[model samples]
Target: MHTRNVVSGVLLGIGVATFVDETVFHQLLHWHHFYDRSTTAMGLVSDGILHAASMVATVAALFLYADLRRRRAFAPRLWWGGLLAGAGGFQLYDGTVQHKVFRLHQIRYDVHLAPYDWAWNVVAVLLLAAGIVLLVRGRR
Candidate 1:
């Protein structure tokens, strides 16, 4: 039940995923920018925007989680399910829509993308499946 808890977890999950993407691929690995069809300055700006948004989401989610805990209405199972689902959903969308459909950016550039694409999507699906299973179990 506890819809608020689930929402909080989902937001946190999205924030975490975005943070990881920005830090690992964009920063550490020097992968493509959020918008690759632009100058380096523009790409950096886009990354900054994405980072800000993710931070906002993380802070908001944490505040909501704190409130739920204070109220003693936190639902652990549902929250976990929501977290996994949110992360998986975001990843899947990024892998498919952002990469393929919109051509915003790819997992990696100047490389054969089939394996990376498959791995990314497969992981997303697994996460989503685990979340669904948890949600169903939590319902009972």
Candidate 2:
């Protein structure tokens, strides 16, 4: 598997996960918004921006993967690793940067955040560890 393929796959996974988060949590579940300081309208705008970015990323990744496949350089193991890593990284960023550092919004409103934060970060760490292991094993 080509290294580029792995990277591309990761990008795709990240984008997809982001889209899911935006659609499910932001719109459907109504748990939280991208920026809690603003109105719901602003929140929708933020979600639109996020959705656009995710679409771009997903398209870019697919294009790159197609190119690599045409060249017969796609590697399954490495690509899977990248996918796991990308998804995990996004979750970690959301937990640490958005939820904690930025004070944007918690996983839920008027509820205990410790459990949500702990679970989010822990799952992210596991995903990252699994990705690293797969990447290393793939290289061997």
TM-score of each: 0.96, 0.94
In candidate 2, stretches whose alpha carbon ends up further than 4 angstroms from where it belongs are none
lDDT of 2: 0.86
Error of 1 at 20 (Å): 0.7
Best by lDDT: 1
Candidate 2 TM-score versus the reference: 0.94
RMSD of each: 1.0, 1.2
111 Cα displacement, candidate 1 (Å): 0.7
Give the per-residue lDDT of model 2 (tens digit) for 32-78: 88877789899888888889999998998999898888988888888
Q: Which pairs clash in model 1?
A: none
- What C-alpha lDDT values do all the predictions have? 0.88, 0.86
Report the error of model 2 at residue 50, Å. 0.5
